[model samples]
Target: MFLLSLPFSLASAAELKFTNADESRAEFERSVKPFLTKHCVGCHGAKEPEGELDLTTLDPDMKSSTSGARWATLVEKLTKGEMPPEEKPRPDAAGLAATIDWAHAESKRANRNFTRRAAYENGNITPHSVLFDPKNIPPFDGESRVRRVSPEIYETFLKDAAKRPGTNQPFSPLGGTTFKDMGDPTIDEPVTATLFRNALIIVEGQTVHTVENGKIVKWNGARELQPLFDPQVAPTDAQLEAAITFQFKQILKRPPTDRELEKFVALLKRNMAEAGQVVGSRYALATVLMLTEAVFRMEVGSGQPDEKGRVRLAPREIAFAIGYALTDKGPDSQLLAAAATGGLGTDEGVTQQVRRLLDDAKTDKPRILRFFREYFGYDKASYVFKEANSGGGTIDFPGHDPGSLIADTDRLIEYILEQDRDVLRELLTTNKTFVAYRTAADWQKKLVEARKKFDAEKKANPEKYKNREFNPPVKMVCEAYGLSDFPEQQPVELPKDQRAGILTQPSWLVANSTTFDNHAIHRGKWIRERLLGNVVPDVPITVDAQLPNTPEKTLRERMAVTEQAYCWKCHQLMNDLAYPFEQFDHFGRYRAMDSVVDIEATAKLEGPRRNQTKRVMQDVPLNRSGLVAHVGDASLEGPVDGAVELMHKLAASERVEQVFVRHAFRYWLGRNESPGDAASLQAAHKAYQESGGSMKELLSALLTSESFLYRVPASPEPNAVPKAASKKANS
Candidate 1:
């Protein structure tokens, strides 16, 4: 659509298409020489050849030389959109195109004789080739990087250690804690210590129907698997020695050092001789402590058992890893002790262990329940009202007269396993729990009374409860169920939005709050950091500043506008996210309408704003906007078809999958998966999808993947700077 123009003097151009030298010279002068003279000669030609590049004095004969390559390099600069100097006299589009074509033609002719280079000559893989070229990779090959004798290896090691006829024994929980802290091992601590972390496992079962014809035929077996970790369970005097030796071998992926082996023997002998019992619980506890170390941490191995890089963990260790990762409490001592005695080796014991792990009144009921909540981003299950089933379980609410008690653990598990509904709906909407009313009525009554009393105390003194609400109450249930409590409160709800989800829960409001301030900066930051995983560093402490207290004003206005500047520096991000939860009252109960005068609904969370506003003035609480309405499975009526469909949609999304994978990676790998790990992660992610997102399958894939078992750190690359700019400046 556009006409062309060119000037003579093609000889000066660096690159040009030509049938011969004469043709190239003509093309260069006619199409490229004039343009360069007008736009580039002033800086690089006669007066000053910046970076030693002079377009006006360009030599047509030096076609194969590096100096002749400068013009071709300039064309690349223009292609990348980083040139034109912004203030310089730039060539028009057509002129630039002509230059580009000429440069490419000359480059091709000049590079014609260059031969392709072969791979490494000595067979020693170069870093560049090994990383950049997949085919050149030889160092890894699974056997080299993938260490054998994971927890699976531990089983053999334990057997060996136990048979070694040593004197060291396992630690006991009854006598006292025997496990030393992983971060600090100066003092022996209980396995139930506060440093425990829980692992999350989501299960989805697909019903496979085998139909030969139209009529129903038979049901295929149900494939069930879970993300499991093996814990070191060695209790006997000899077992302790074997466990340490085995741990060293597994961690190092080779034989243990003689010195290390001797140390293990010495430690075991001392423990057994001092404790006066080789088969005591102490020996088992000590072994568990060793397994908790970083060396024992394994990635979700390859999705399949036969994967080349798969990291294998022993069965008991798998159980321990699952328990430790999923809950604040470490491995269940009872389960470990049972395992140490080899009771879990039989079919019945294995089944019992699975059931026991899931049925342990201490961990399964409360700790596992909390683990689910932690994964779901909620502190507790939502309330729900459902008629008790035919399951025989007495229900009870202690502290409250005539409270029903739930006797069976199965009934309790069923009541909480409704994965379709958000926990908020289950906790606030449900009033019924499968309880053996007659069996646990008295205990149930006491608990109900305590809750009622707690609720009454909160209502009587709004100020007292205001800062006390948020996730604390749900956490209390966890503690009562024997799980270690995090004891930190987080604002989970907005004041305007009732339903006591976060704002009113006892754990969230009081743990980090002041008696007077409902939403203190400290509490707000804690909620953002802990609940949302936002890493908001702490602000420097200063003298307490008096904040305005008005019924009409939101927390932000009262703090930022009235408070000093030192506060806003850090409060900016906190206010953006926290203010949204103000819709919830202190008791976590949502109110459709509040009778209080000068009703206020202004709060914001901590994050950068699009408008770059200094204050959170325009944002409205979630309740007022109807964005956060009551949601429940029953409310949708009938079966949760829509919710299931939505979940499928989320699971299918790359973003959602990434979130799950990231969370799972952090759990299994003990650190954030680096971008360099993307290859292995990509492979594992593919396996996960292929395995239908089965929690166990995904974990298997990750554990077996190269990134999980290998410990090689990624190398950094040097920053690249275009050579054209350097040459131009020098001229």
Candidate 2:
């Protein structure tokens, strides 16, 4: 009879709405209590509350206890379609609608109550508003956001501390009861998905343990720690001292001594002073805790910008900065610690030391190439030029033949660093590649045979070959042909045609192009995005359907007929940049005929905002040479000469220098460039220009910046303290 009466009361209330807030609450408790007690109490009851949620007690009837808080939370979860989860029996459509309707009302009332209470406690709502505004969210300020390590940092940290490589088995940092209550029902936090993919971390052979109250109990044991996690074992006293010393040295950029060693030893002893189980285990646990997601990323300040308008890099970022600036071998904790402590100074002595260290010819190529890859979007070391007969991926060419170059690693480093040309300029426009002698020689022989056939054919038909330019013989063939006949291919001679810059270089040309035939749109997009700081929207794969098998068709032709009602918004810019590079085919080899088609290779490539296209040299009127010639004619400056000047201007620009510095700063510091950082960036930019854009100079400037040295970001207005005059007078 009571259950039947409850339905009558709810139906009556639904027909007539209550105007008072108290009436609404009364109506809710009366109508909803029966259903909640019967259906929800089993799992979300006061005792064995599932998901730490109890929907029965809520709002005015529920006080400040944790379980009472869970009611409001349960209301939200049910409304979001996230609870009564897939495993549970789903509510019928009518029931679901009623639950959702109640949840929204309850959430609104709860927020209103909170706001009133907060307003009463505080003089103003401004403070609360500052922290909880839904819109205009600030960038993540390295607080709770640094909840987990990135894969790269995790690997390095584990290897350094555990003397173990990261397992490929799946692993999660969360464990035990903490894992179960991961998503607090009373709050809006979501449970995270498990980590580990691609069989990256195997757990089959390991006996994972849970550390609770300083005891290392095996998993499924008596006591439950917060969550399942594999903590690092404690380092031996000597090892701890060694690691700390190494870190200090790296951060300070110098070695630590006896006094500094004593401090680290003292820290170890302090870990053992607390009351706990195994002393060593406790100490080990302390170290692990320090290295956990919470402490490992030590973001300081209230996440608000500090007085100097700068947010200091945390320990992890400091480590990254150190690793990026000093080595390509990857991050080392010891190196980071040293860099943090003024050990790595930018004084002349340290500079000389670094120069000598990097001078080793063996490691130099890899290091420089890594820097090139990071900054300029190219890395020769990892590049593959051809596919092997066995076939997995393409093959790479080492700088030297296997047995030909000197074996010393230092010698290799020296070779990469000792070149006299401007390093930046070389990155942009050098055709004199450092190819293996064997590969160079093999191509030479092939070219010689090709030239003989060409000459014979030309003699037979004078009209066809009389004025046409012949393909240059290969280097080895030219060596045999003597320098006079094929000067461009001869060994140890300046290239006659240094027309290609970084964009047109064989490696870059092949790297950016999707098809063997260059797509003007792709080329234009690349230039705009990578070179000119414009964002290009991605085209759909379906767009590729428009292409036909006509090998001789130009990129413009492909785009025009590729799609029905195809838009040319991006194509115009792309074609402009691409037509000039038509001289080079898909493989980045020069071509007269595209596949079997006669090259309609001639193009008049015009400069940006310019009147006409430049004509380059061309056998066929459509070739790249005619375009270059047309471009060249506009300036009367000639092609190679004009390119050289442009390269110099670009390398010397303040803007270009800053872009490099900003990029390095972003990578090393683990933070984006903030407006506050503009001054420091400019300082580094200035230093780079003054040092003739030496990469080393830029590093020195960055390390010296206040952003690098401080543990917290500086505030916007320095020396502008509130009540400053009063304080000064009182003092």
Candidate 3:
């Protein structure tokens, strides 16, 4: 988004003149090859090549060599400033731009229509420092693409149309680090076949069932096919049109276009000619379910491109995007009316609608909740497998109940979101967490008390008790190490020492845990990438990633393998940040003894635990001290006692808040920020800070930013500018 001043590289790049092959190869030697030797050969060459890419021998001639394909794969890596990764040396801006500009020119001349990898394809490709750099806010990276309606949304479409639920969910949502809403599934042969089969099942499942003579019958609602059920009467154009219109509204949420109307009608007649009325009508409805419009909600802008090649999304597209961004359903009637009446055209207009939907309590804004869940990654707790039935293995005490602390974490997040004040900080440092009512251990005690009171009341007043069924006021809360079921709208407060924010929550701890121990490396990596907004380079292929899982050694001792100079380069970013969490075990039980696994709650309840606590839970010294570093702020970087202290420090940092805002951009905008998107990110950060950390204001500002409202379709000379550095002399 930096305003593209006329390129200084034009005089330099014009020297290459890829008009033919010979001149280009000569220029590659003069400029490209020599420049890379001086700037890039350090990591990408012979000594220790990363990503299996040996750039020293790569051919620069895109016109003829086999290396053209390899260059295709690497274009984004080079242009996005991901080359010479943060830890390594990099070219000055002019040197970097010259190399990238050379790549673009060659690719254009080669006429290679390689698939463009947008920001959503890989969020970590852009530098975090570059993204949040306050002084260099660019115009904006307006996204331009259409995402297929996710499998979940397609299932809802089925439910709305046929009055039946979907079963064959072909689109599996991605998990771990990636945003739920951002996906681009290729629709090739097999995918097309799956959609066809899925659609047929939905249409056929709606038929009414009945026996000719005897017992009761099942009713199937083939309501769309009802008129065609009577084959004795020949079908008319009117009936076909009515069916198509109905299916259009039920599935696509809009009336069919004249072209679409004719296309479907012709389809019905052709099928009817071959296979009778019932099959034809049924196939026709199923076909409607598979329309491209039905499958993918287009976010591609509506109007012609502006002078800068940006396009604002049309009102209807805006409505659809906003609806799915905040909720599971399509735009409501009010939202649709606004789109129809041009209420989504301007910034104020779009802001008005977004604010209305966000404010409406009845609207199930699950996307808001989903953002936090995915952001913190606590939802992965269930996926971390541990055996409960095998008694020899550690009993998942606090984790015994299915999703026990997961629900607790959810409630805590909801509580903070409801208050909506400094939400990110509250989620990180809040001491008040939801545990089972009163005490999880006292459920039976409370039940006894409730029964005693109930019996006394019944004894005193027999007439009143005659018709009443006894239900205990004190009941078990089936999460937070819960054993029984209790119905309560809100949970009781847990003490400060017992919990602190999402990071310290038992579910998150359990989720991040490896099979045998707490995944401190992964945990620190998560904080490094997610909270600190930095990328940890992929583990080089040569490094053996597995720790020597020695139960006899402490987790740190086992991790001794990572301290080698090569390994430590990346490990330094994670280990110090992660060790603080060692005070809590994989199950998130406080580890008083270093060597002994903490006793689970269920182990105490079911067995002779007093003896087992002494036998199984033996002793060793504990180390909870850890350091926070590389986060840019010296004030925020230091030694800390444990996760609580760590989380508090992170929660208070402006850098961390900006990281949170960047993630919210990913969730709301559905892509990582491009260089142009710095403007949007900065504006949103300013709004959050100025609004006293209101998520609503932050979201409003982001949703209305230039990046949200408009899109750049392709790279242009006018925009897509790189930060410039002076041309460097080659070695």
Candidate 4:
């Protein structure tokens, strides 16, 4: 009778249109309490609760209660019949339906209140506005600020400064995280601090010494500012001004305006009055000009917007942009000449410069190598920690170091670019690889020669060779005699069929692995996000994501837990994509078994060993079946058996080609693409397809696009009242 009366009371409350907090609380007390007492209180009551839920203490007001989410979860469990455990008493059909309806209504109210509070706190309905949406994006607002020189460009600039005609200071490279300089706009305090610290070091003559041949050698390089200040040749006032002008041109990449020249000259004169002329000039160049934004940042033109809401970049700005896009240094003589003649302001002029820069051997190799290094991220191999004692240590085979692996990858990229035929496809499917150590016989011969030379030197001069650095020769001996140490740098050719493309390289494999094991998820995520242009959502906060560590079972077998219904929702997208890499171990060596006996065990027993842990080989079947989905192109989406097969499919994919072009756009533009950038992207893609996938042609198209050449100013807000209208209304 009581249960039947509850629905009637709820109906009456509903008819009364109860909306306020007090009224809603009253309704919940009358209709919801009876249901919870009868069906849920046994397991979820005050004394002892199930799943950390206590229903009796829960507040009737869902919006104000912290337990509102728990109520919603309970409702879901009841709806799905996952609760009550099949043996416990279950609510009848009508009773269950009533409870579910009330829970859902309260949940919606709570969510609405939460969202409203968040919006109020943030001062907007959305915290962050999307910068780019394919359907709608505003025109480019030539609103770029003077950005600081990137780490790479700054290092090159410093090296060049040290090599100037009168300077004798050895350049000390600055080190810090360079993400901000590399187009990440987020302000980093560390990078800023590092720049300031390095500037001071360059200004003051600090003694920098190096240890050579067991003796400390002091380099007086920092004190020798002979190029900037020569005591033997005292300059007149006019000569000093000329010298300052030359420096401004070199450091800022442009001759200073009259006002800037006047300010700097005054600074130099004040310093000279206090100290000597040499000290004054050094202080002005190092501490003053070098720290200014003119030297640190690449500044474009700034002026009032024209009728079309557009502005053109200054000629000098265009020259700097073109030069930095192709090389780490400032503009060359030809580029500076073009800027002076105003020839860099047109599409045809820009194309000619781009062609010349691309063809120049000085610019081509390093730019292309750096581009691939950033794109593939295989350079991270130098930093990734790998365990030497584990089976994965096989990557240290005969004649390979992390550095050589990186260089080999760079060489392969250079080779492909030279071919200029379907470059992306070749990168994905090419099987040939360059290596420092190739055939067993050649490796042995080099090792023998190095060992013989070391033995002869040590025997011939016992006293002189004492405390000599013998590691290099010892490492060579190890490689020659089939010992443990990896060989040093020397190029050789690997068998063509042993590898296929960048994916199969040791550098990439080591980079994406943990110290003792492979992370298939990370590898798969990279391919999905980078190559396929698909996004994989982060793991849910509520989930404790971890795979079981079962030594007896293979990695694939242990990963079967992801096949469960709840976990499969997200894991299905990543696990299958990464499965193909199982053929290679964590250290990137191909193996039929999951673990292999340590081949360097004999070398360890012979003398002091690097890794002393015992190793055991284990046989396990590797599953290489993988699926590529959401490619839009149907032909490239399906199951694959191995890394080679996966690469073949990727090579044939149109989506892959588009993604490569998109990455190139981002790399050169130093920012993500916007809706306004669609025309530029399309032009580059068209160029790639038309020119038989030539990267040079694609770059030319991007540089000549309207998106790169012009910029529009931001529009005024709609709510803003015009000054003329306001005055007329007042009159």
Task: Quantify all predictions' global Cα lDDT against the true fold.
Answer: 0.38, 0.40, 0.70, 0.60
Candidate 1 RMSD computed on C-alpha atoms after optimal superposition onto the true structure: 23.5
Candidate 2 regions with alpha-carbon error over 4 angstroms: 1-166, 169-290, 293-307, 311-320, 328-368, 374-421, 437-501, 540-549, 559-566, 592-621, 625-658, 670-674, 706-731
**TM-score ranking from best candidate downward:** 3, 4, 2, 1
Per-prediction TM-score: 0.35, 0.45, 0.74, 0.65
User: Across residues 1-731, which tens digit of lDDT does each residue of candidate 1 receive?
Assistant: 00112222222233434655566678778977877777667766776455445666665533423233345335534543334555786568667667756765664455421111101001111111112223423333221121112222233234433322232222221111011111111223542231121000000111223445433354432221000101222245345445555544433333456776676666655655566432222342244334434224432332234333333344454445444443433346665666458654444554455445543445533433432333332222122122232111222111111111112222332343434233323332232333232344344455567688878888899886887843333333332222233223221112221222223333333333333234556544543333322323323223354566664555545665623464554454355434433443332222233222233222342344423322222223332221111111122212111112222222333433544454455444433333345565556556666755544445555544555444432222232223443232222
- Model 2, 1-731: lDDT tens digits are 00110111123212333444576567566655655664566776778554334455444322111222234345434433345555667555445445434433443433322211221121111111122233423322221223233333434333433322444312233221101101111111121211221111212112235567765566642122212232445446665565555444322333556875676566645644453223432243333223233113333423344564545555444444444445533434454444456444433423443454444344422434434444443233124333331111222221212221112112222333356334454444444433323345555666678788899999999999999866654432222112234333312323425333455444455554553345555555544333333223335332453466654555545555532444343343344445556655544445444333333322333355123222122233343421112111133212322323444434443333444565565544444344335555666666766876565666666665655545443222332323433243123
As for lDDT, the candidate ahead, 2 or 4, is: 4
- Judged by lDDT relative to the true structure, which candidate is superior, 1 or 3? 3
Kindly give the number of clashing pairs for every candidate. Answer: 145, 71, 6, 2
lDDT of 1 at 190: 45
Arrange candidates, best lDDT first. Answer: 3, 4, 2, 1
Q: Give the lDDT of residue 34 in candidate 1.
A: 79
Stretches of candidate 3 off by over 4 Å are 1-33, 36-74, 77-118, 164-166, 174-177, 205-225, 388-399, 437-498, 596-617, 715-731
> Which model scores highest in TM-score?
3
lDDT of 4 by residue, 248-367 (tens): 765666677888778877777787767875567666765543445434444445466667566766777778777777787867889889988978867788889989988777663355
